[model samples]
Target: MTILLFGITKDIVGQPTLSLSHSEAQGLHTAGELKEFLKDNYPDMKKLSSLAVAVNSEYAQDEHAIKEEDEIAIIPPVSGG
Candidate 1:
């Protein structure tokens, strides 16, 4: 699976996207689990004020199941004036 990163997430991850294998995301069946996986891999992610998970271009709830081929993105908070 590939996860797109935006804003601060991109900065922290040092890349626009991340590629992970099914084994890397093992046991991550839901959006919530995905968050935990990310936090575990990237501790800096937990410092973000907020992070939203999007699947297939739509905001996903914690219960949203993550499929191997689904498009996932980490949308961090944006601030502008």
Candidate 2:
């Protein structure tokens, strides 16, 4: 699975895109699992005030199911004065 990163999320991950191997992709069954994986791999991601996940281009809740063929995106919190 390929995960697109946006805003601070891209900066936190230090990449615009993240690719999961077929085996890894199969291991992640839900958006929440994906988030945990990211946090484990990239601890900085856990520092964000809030994280939003988009699956198949639509915002997904933790319970949202995910699949290897699905499109995913990570969106971090934003703040402006």
Candidate 3:
């Protein structure tokens, strides 16, 4: 899948994205599992809240079903000070 990953996600994954493996490809193997995947891989993000996500340009939830051919992205929490 092509994930339009952004924010710290890039740092965690070490890249924007390419092809992910099934071992960590949450929804790719079964149902929606973005939250689980993040918590497992990106433990630091566990504290992040009120974050929004978009799948293929549409707002989505952690449990939102993911397709192998879908494009996903995490809408980071914007900060300005």
Candidate 4:
């Protein structure tokens, strides 16, 4: 699975996108699982005050299912004057 990163999330990951092997994402069936996986693997991700998971361009909840073909992105809190 591919995860797009934006704003602070991108900075934390040091890239615009991240790819996870099938085995890595195999156990992550829900958004909550994905969050835990990310937090465990990428400690910096836990620093975000708020992180929104978007699947297919829509904000997803913890119960949202994650599919291999779905487009996923991490949106960190943003502020602008």
Most lDDT-accurate candidate: 2
lDDT of 1: 0.89
**CA displacement after TM-score superposition, residue 51 of candidate 4 (Å):** 0.8
Could you tell me which residue pairs clash in candidate 2?
A: none
Q: Please rank every candidate by lDDT, starting with the best.
A: 2, 1, 4, 3
Writing each residue's lDDT as its tens digit, candidate 2 over 9-71 gives: 798888899999999888899999999999999998888768999998899999999999999
User: lDDT for every model?
Assistant: 0.89, 0.92, 0.66, 0.88
**Where's the lowest-lDDT run of ten residues in candidate 4?**
41-50
C-alpha RMSD by candidate, in order: 1.1, 1.1, 2.8, 1.0
Candidate 4, superposed: residue stretches over 4 Å from native: none
Give the local distance difference test score of model 2: 0.92
Candidate 1 residue pairs that clash: none
Clashing pairs in 3: none
lDDT of 4 by residue, 1-81 (tens): 999999887887788999989988788899878888888888988777678999999999989999988899998878977
The best candidate by TM-score is: 2
lDDT of 3 by residue, 48-79 (tens): 76657688788886667777767777666757
